[model samples]
Target: MIIFFFLQSKIFIACVLMNLLIALCCFHFC
Candidate 1:
């Protein structure tokens, strides 16, 4: 159960970070 939560949060954080990075890159180019 603890490990599942840890992985879930990590994945969520990673997704958010990647989303932000993609938005920033698009904004910079456009």
Candidate 2:
């Protein structure tokens, strides 16, 4: 259970970082 939660949190953080990167790219180009 703890291992599963850790993986989930890692995925969540990755998703957030991806979204932030996309937003930065849009702001720079558009």
Candidate 3:
């Protein structure tokens, strides 16, 4: 249970970071 929760949180953080990175790249290009 603890490992599952930790993995889920890590994935959520990674997704958020990825989204921010993509948004920044798009804004920079456009």
- The candidate scoring highest on TM-score is 2
Per-residue alpha-carbon lDDT of candidate 2 for residues 1-30, written as tens digits (9 for 90 to 100): 999999999999999999999999999999
Candidate 1 Cα lDDT to native: 1.00
lDDT of 1 by residue, 1-30 (tens): 999999999999999999999999999999
Clashes per candidate (backbone, < 3 Å): 0, 0, 0
Candidates in order have lDDT scores of: 1.00, 1.00, 1.00
lDDT of 3 by residue, 1-30 (tens): 999999999999999999999999999999
Model 2 — which ten-residue stretch has the worst lDDT? 21-30
* TM-score of every model versus the real structure: 0.93, 0.96, 0.89
> How well does candidate 3 score on lDDT at residue 25?
100
Q: Lowest summed-lDDT stretch of 10 residues in model 3?
A: 1-10
Stretches > 4 Å off in candidate 1? none
Q: How does residue 12 of candidate 3 score in lDDT?
A: 100
